[model samples]
Target chain A: MTQHTTGAYDEELRDLVSRIAEMGGLAEGLVSEAVTGLARIDIARAQNVIFNDHRLDDMQRQVEERAISVIARRQPVARDLREIIAALRVSSDLERVGDLAKNIAKRVIAIDGQFHTKRLAFGVEHISEITLEQLKAVLDAYTSQDLDAAHAVRSRDDEIDAMYTSLFRELLTYMMEDPRNITFCTHLLFCAKNIERIGDHATNIAETIHFMITGEYLQEDRPKQDESSYIPAGYSSE
Target chain B: MTQHTTGAYDEELRDLVSRIAEMGGLAEGLVSEAVTGLARIDIARAQNVIFNDHRLDDMQRQVEERAISVIARRQPVARDLREIIAALRVSSDLERVGDLAKNIAKRVIAIDGQFHTKRLAFGVEHISEITLEQLKAVLDAYTSQDLDAAHAVRSRDDEIDAMYTSLFRELLTYMMEDPRNITFCTHLLFCAKNIERIGDHATNIAETIHFMITGEYLQEDRPKQDESSYIPAGYSSE
Candidate 1:
């Protein structure tokens, strides 16, 4: 009887971990599709990303519900409790990542006919590719519970921030070069910001994994190279 | 002994609720101060908003810790479970609101020396004011468990969306008007988007409250008037 009960409990936890992996996979796909749509200005591709977000949202809800139910039934403490809570945290981050991708898709649609600048999205796409890699690595680290891999994902977030800063400068330069580029450039700027935030969410998932494994919150401040927040576009610290 | 244990559990739940309330108050203050700083271009006020965000973050962490501890101790199900989960959700929404406010404050500092257009902050300020009110009402409804009030807050999110749409148009016009205005207007556009996101968080909290009271997720689509997502600023849809 005890073996049966333990088997059922293990199955529940395993299901939750798998669901989170599914969310992570779908979120990565949406983000990749969204950024590609922006780069190519393909409204149909962007729409697919937009529509796929609902399935991601549904999966997130299911994960949260399952996590809460496990907590209630198992009365889990310590490690079990941490795993359930981490599932909740990771799922929420994945949901936000999906929403951010949808935001980029919306911009792609918004800028569809404007077609004023095609080269502009290259920077946005490049940053997104890096963010997607971080996301995939963190999700893998989370499922495998690899501490070093999680730390690696956490350490790499600053590079994405630095890349986003440079992208911000590129978009700003494009806007200032001609008034006509302002509309499309602004959308690309937000697309880049959305990708940067996806990187942040990946870092968040990494921290959740770290805390789950170590039972200690990562204490140090995340190094941020996003000085774009401090420096206005036209200004030069040089 | 049973009574004493029950009292302790109740105390833990009470502490979680009060901590969430404290976080809500701090988030509201941060939003108001951040927007006011933008209006007046007050660097000190903006800096204060940025620093005080740490307090809000700490409060959220504390709330989550207490909520999880309660779930572990009480093994709460049904209504008690809902209340605990609601606290977790509300704290998260409030934390994101604080982050959004800090984003606005950062933009204020970024645009500080430009002084390109004092009038531009007016529209941004107006939209933020409405969002703040929505946040306040939603937090109050969440604490009081007022379903009607939550619905009211949910209903009004559309108005905030409308206000954000107009503000987006105004900022777009300012940017397209001159290259000089592009830099400052870009900052303002992000600030406005941040405020709009705060409103979305408020609506999210309201939905959480509704779920807590009714034990059912709100099923209707949130009416969004944010047509700016589909319209490029320089192009006339007509």
Candidate 2:
């Protein structure tokens, strides 16, 4: 009887992990489709990303429900409890990632035909590619409980931030060069910001993985290099 | 012995709720201070808001730890388990709201002495005021488990969204009118977006409350009126 109970609990835990992996896969797909739609100006693909966000949301609910049920039934302690909590945290992050992707996809529909700049599209595509890689790596680290892999994902977020900063400057210059470019470039700017935020969420998931494994908070401050700081020259409001 | 165990579990649950309330209060204060700092350009106040955000983060960790401990100890089922999960979810939302407020405060430091536009500052103040109201109402609803109040908060998010959309247009116009206004208005734009996002987080809390009370997902689609759809005149990329 005790063996049967242990086997059931193990099965439940495995099922929770598998559901999280499925949710991660869906989120990654949405990110890819959203950015691809932007680069290629594919409204149909963008719409698909937007419509499919509900699936991620549903999956997140399922993960939370299952995790909570397991906690109630098993009364898991210490590391076991932390693993259940981690699933909840990771699912929430994945859901937010999906929402961010949907935000980018919406921009594709919003900026349908104002102006198509291949250079700007290329910049966005490049940033999205890097962010997607980070997201994939973190999700893998999460499933495998690889602390080093998670740390690697956390360390690489600065690259996305730097790319976003340069893109911001480039988009600003484009707007200044042509007033007509303002509308289109502004949409692209938002899309880039959304992708950058996805990178941040991936880093968040990495931290959760570390906490899950160690049952302790990460003591180091997260390395952040978002260059949104706009210090005006010769300005002292103090 | 059973009665004594129940009493102890009740005490733990109560402690979790109290910590969440305390965290909510801090998050609310941070929002108020951050926006007030922006309106007055009070760098000191903004710095305080930024510094205090770490406290909210710490509180979130505490809430999670406490909730997990309770679950492990009591093995709460049904409503009891849901209540613990609600505390965790609410604390997470509150922490994100604190972070959003800090993001706004950081903008205060970023755009220190570039160009202070009284009208723009007033606009941000107005939007922040409404968002603060929504947040307070939602937080109260959460504590009381008042579904109607939660729904009211959700319904009011469109007001914030509409305000944000208009503010975005107004800020874009300001930037276009003068290159000098670019840096300042851009910062204000981001601050406004941050406040708008706080409103969304409040809506998220309301949804969590609904789930906690009903044990089911909110079946209705979230009311979203972020009027960012820009259909340029005479444009068709298809």
Candidate 3:
């Protein structure tokens, strides 16, 4: 049965759901703030993002401990078991997302005052916004147990990958154009990579949701649109 | 009390330990081949690394499924529960290690015919070998339940971080010195990052071992040595 015999067990499950939601919110805010920090070069905001990640990490640990405790004590099976598993998976994803955000924030500090290229920052921000939306939607899907929303998030992952490809190309071109831009562009490229990875984590959460609902792993290969990996050394689109 | 009464439960636990060892071996081989491929610019070898990652993925899936099945069916408690949990955590870390290796291999393919600088490749290989050894030691610890070896792996992680920071500087200097070095150095930089991340995953596995044995999360903040984040734009060691 989905409902446990004891009220205490049900209460524990509810706590997991809420904890995941909290973690999601924290992770999302970190991503948004990190990108904002990078785009605006706000050192304090980026440092704040860095400082705040430990909270997410702690919450993730709490979620895992709670889930394991509930499993051993309650012997949950079927949907209840899946719910616990999903909580574990999603919290881990959020923790990784937090790390990605922190990576971005770290680069924000690394490039502080050295960044004069305003135009290059916009593409990074644009991709960040899309990834932020994707992360938000997937987390919402988890709270509502909405399968369709999760699938949509999974399908849209390629969009983030595509944007990251273009951003990678753009940064490399800027670095090539002027030797002075090399250091900043390299840092920006990493920031874009961090953002792109956040999008992958969103897709991972979406897959976790799929597993929770359908009781099967999402079997289709991820439609990866980022071909920057195979881009020619010559930078020719041909 | 350590031994379960049922023959099947003990069998399941043994299977999990063996699977983890198997996954560890596969992950280690992939990392070795990827670095070798990177250093030698061996496209065929890199392609093999990329192709072999799916096997690691499949084994990780089996480890998780089996762990979950045993948990639900056996309702293991205490040490048994921790053992199963360790399997899950280790498999996940190994899967990530596989991904990092595959990423390096992908870059190997990306820069296929263009790579000429030999020195850049050597530093990467040096770091990779150290990280690979750490991974092997950690996996052996996991298999033998040797807490001491795990602790050793955990402590040496900063060495990899230091190497990565220096490599980061080296790549940037090369890029600045000659624009022709930009693309190759950029790719090398990412390869170094992937290796550094593999080190982190090894450290993560070490922490998992600590948790498995002591039944408490390692609460101390990791000794992070990679201060590449704060390295100045001017590339001066000062």
Q: Predicted chain A of model 3: TM-score relative to the true chain A?
A: 0.96
**Number of the top candidate by lDDT?**
3
lDDT of 2 by residue, B64-160 (tens): 8888877877778877788889999999999999989998888888767656676767778999999999999998998888999999999899999
**TM-score of candidate 1 relative to the true fold:** 0.95
lDDT of 1: 0.84
Backbone clash pairs for candidate 3 read: none
Ranking by lDDT: 3, 1, 2
DockQ of each: 0.59, 0.43, 0.62
DockQ of 2: 0.43
Candidate 3 lDDT tens digits, B196-229:
9999999999999999888989964887756677
RMSD (Cα, Å) of model 2: 3.7
Error of 3 at B231 (Å): 2.0
User: In model 3 chain B, where is the ten-residue run with the lowest total lDDT?
Assistant: B229-238
Interface RMSD of 3: 1.8
